[model samples]
Target chain A: SQQGEEDPQALSIQEGENATMNCSYKTSINNLQWYRQNSGRGLVHLILIRSNEREKHSGRLRVTLDTSKKSSSLLITASRAADTASYFCATVWNNDMRFGAGTRLTVKP
Target chain B: GAGVSQSPSNKVTEKGKDVELRCDPISGHTALYWYRQRLGQGLEFLIYFQGNSAPDKSGLPSDRFSAERTGESVSTLTIQRTQQEDSAVYLCASSLTSGSFSYEQYFGPGTRLTVT
Candidate 1:
C-alpha cells in the first residue's frame, strides 16, 4: 500500500523556471527520498533527507523534511527540459519503504 | 563495479502460464528488492531480501506470487498461473546493506511483463 500522496499531481512550466512538489506521509520515518522517472524507464534516485536533517541540496535539487507535519517538499531550480519526468517521494522506516503516486512535471523547452 | 541487472527485459505470456524473472544484484550488495509498477502508477513493493535472512513477502498481492534468492547473488520472482492483472513492469533494486541509514538503492532497467 502507498504511504502518502503527492500534491499538484501534474505541473507544466517553461524552461528556466523553478518547479516545486510536495509530499505528505503518515507515521514516522527514518528518512525521505526523492526519485525521478522518465517515461517507460526505471527510477533515478535524486536526494535523501534524514529525519534529523531539515534540508539538503544536490545540484539544482533541494529537499526539505518536516517531521512534525509528516511532510516534505522537493524543489527543482532552473528547470530544464531534461527535468521533465515523474517525481516520487518515498518514506523509509526501518527496512520497509513506501512511495506515493508522484508528481508529473513537464518543462516546455 | 557493475550495477544491478535483470534478464529477459520483455516477456509476453498467456494467462495461466507461469513466468520467472531474474535479477542479479550489484556485487557484494546484500539487499535486493522487487517492485511492480503499472502504467502511470507508483511502484508497488513486492518483496525484499537481505543477506541470508528470510525474505519479506508482505506486499505480494496473491499466493501465486513467489520469489527465491540464491544466497545473496541472484533472485527470481515467479508468478504462478499468471493473470492479466499481473501485467506490469517488474523492477529490481539492491542496496549496499539493509540498514535504515543513508544507503541509496540502485535499480535495473526492469522487466516489462505482458500477460495476454
Candidate 2:
C-alpha cells in the first residue's frame, strides 16, 4: 500500500496566482519532500521539511508539515507558466520512501 | 557534476523475455534506489543500496525482480520472464545517504520499458 496520498489530483490556475496542494500519509515520517516532473521526465527535488520543523521556504515555494495529522501542504506563490508540471509528495520512514499519486498543476499564461 | 543517468531511454521486449535496465549514479553518491511508475500511478519503491551495506530488497514486487550495484557506481535491475503488466518507467535515484534524514535524491531520466 502507498503511504502518501495527495488531494486534488489535478489543479489549474492562471499565472501570477497561488496554487496549493495537500498530501496525507498513513505513518510516521522522518521527513517529507516535494518533487516536480515535467511530462515523462524524471522528478526534480523541490523542498524538504523535517518532522521537527513546521514550515520551510524556498524561493516562492512554501511547505508546511503537521506530524500530528500526518499531512503536508505545498504552496507555490506567483505561479508561472513554467510551473506547469506534476507535483508529488514523498514521505520517508526510516530508510524507505514512498510517493503519492501526485497533483498535476497547469499554470495558464 | 553530471547527474544520474540511465541507459536505453526506451526498451520494448516481448513477453517471457528477460530485460535489464541500468543506472549510473552521480559521482561519489553512496545511496542508490530503484522505482517503478505505472501509467497514471504513483512511483513505487523497488530497492535500495547504500555503500557496502546489504541492500534493502523488501520493496521488490516478486522474486523475478532483482538488482545489483557494484562498488557504489553502476546498478542494474533484471527482470526474468517479463509480463505485459510489467510495462512502466523504471527510475533511478541517488542520495548522499540512505536514511530518510539525509539530503534529497537526484533522479535520472529513467528507462521506459514496454513488455508486449
Candidate 3:
C-alpha cells in the first residue's frame, strides 16, 4: 500500500523557474525523503528530512516536513532542463518505506 | 566502491512463464529492498531484508512472487507464472542499515520486465 500521495500530478515550467511539489501521508512517519528518477530507471536520493526537522536544504533543493499535518514539500530553485524528471516523496515508518505516485516535472529549455 | 547493481537490464518473457531478477547490493550494506514500478506509477514495495533477520514479505502481491538473499550480498526475485500485469520495472536498493530511521537507500538501475 502506498503511504504518501503527491499533489499536482504534473507540472511544466520554463528553465530558471522554480518547481514545488507537495506530498501528504496518512500515518505518522519517522522521516520523509525525496527522490528523483530520470528515464524511468534508477532513482537518486535527493534529500531526507527527519520528523524532528522542519526544513532542510541541499544545493538548490529544499525540503520541508510538517509532521503535524503529515505533509512535506520539495522545492527546486532555478530549475534546469536536466531537471525534467519524476520526483517522488517516500514516507519512512520504522523499517518500511512507502513512495507516493510521484509528480512529473518538465522544464523546457 | 560500486553501487547496487541489477542484472539483465531488460527481459521479455511470455505469460505464465517464470522469470528471475537479480540484485547485488553495495558492499558492507546490511539492508536491501525490492520494489516494482508500473508504467507511470509509483513504486510498490515487494520485500525487505535486514542483516540476519527474516525478510519482510508483507508487500508481496501474491504467492507467485518470492525472493531470496544470501546473507547481506546478492538477492534474487523470482516470479512464477508471470502475468501481463506483472510487467514492470523491478528496482533494488540497499542501505547501511534498517530499524533505524537515518540511512538513505541507494538504488540500482532496475530491470525492465515485460510479460507478453
Candidate 4:
C-alpha cells in the first residue's frame, strides 16, 4: 500500500512559471523527505521536513508540512527546463520509509 | 565522495531464471536499503539493513526475494525465480545512520531488470 498520494498526477508549466505538487499520507511520521528523479536516473534528495516543522525552504524549493492534516506540499518557484522531472514524497516512521506514486512535471522551454 | 554505486546498469533475464543485483554503499555509512520501482510508479520499499542487526524483511514480496549485506558495505538482492512482474528497476540507498531522526539516504543508479 502506498503511504502517500500526490495530486495532479502530471503537470505542465512554462519555464518561468511556478509549479506546485501536493502529497497526503495516512499515518504519523517522524519526518518527510522530498526527492526528484530525472528521466532514467536515480532519485535525489531535495528537502526533509521533520514532523515538528511547519515549513522549510532550500534555494527555490519550498516545502510545508501539516502534520495535523497529514499532508505536505512542494513548491518550485521560478521553474526552469532543468526542473523537468518526477517528484516524490516519502514518509519515515520507526526507521521505515514509504513513498508515494509521485508527480511528473514538465517545464516547457 | 563517490556516493553509492551499483553494477550492470541494465539486466535482462528470462522467467523462472535467477538474477542477482548488487549495491555498494558510501564508505563509513552504516545503513543500507533496497527498493523496487515498477514502470511509472513510485518506489516500493523492499528491505533495510542497519549495521549488523537483523534486516527488516517485512516489505519483501515473497520467499523468493532475499538480500544480504556484507557488514555495512556491500549488499546483494537475489530473486530465485524471476517472474514477468519482477521486471523493474531495483534501487539501493545508504544512510549515515539509522537511529533517531537523521535518516537522509543516498541512492545509486538503479539496475533495470527486464524479465521476459
> What is every candidate's C-alpha DockQ against the true complex, given to 2 decimals?
0.74, 0.69, 0.80, 0.70
- lDDT (Cα, tens digit) per residue for candidate 1, span B10-36: 999999999999999999888889999
Q: Best by lDDT, which number?
A: 3
Clashing pairs in 4: none
Candidate 2 residue A65 Cα shift, in angstroms, is: 0.8
lDDT of each: 0.91, 0.92, 0.94, 0.92
lDDT of 4 by residue, A4-99 (tens): 888889999999999999999999899999999987568999999999999999999999999999999999999999999999998988877888
Candidate 2 clash pair list: none
Best by TM-score: 3
How far does residue B86 in candidate 1 sit from its true spot (Å)?
Answer: 1.0
Could you give the TM-score of chain B for each candidate, in order? 0.96, 0.96, 0.97, 0.97
Estimate the Cα RMSD of every predicted model relative to the unseen true structure. Answer: 1.1, 1.4, 1.0, 1.2
Clashing pairs in 1: none
Which scores better on DockQ, 2 or 4?
A: 4
lDDT of 3 by residue, B3-116 (tens): 999998999999999999999999999989999999998899999998899999999999999999999999999999999999999999998864567768899999999999
Which candidate, 2 or 3, has the higher TM-score? 3
Global CA lDDT computed for model 2: 0.92
The best candidate in terms of DockQ:
3
iRMSD in angstroms, per model: 1.1, 1.6, 1.0, 1.3
Q: Residue B60 in candidate 4 has what lDDT?
A: 96
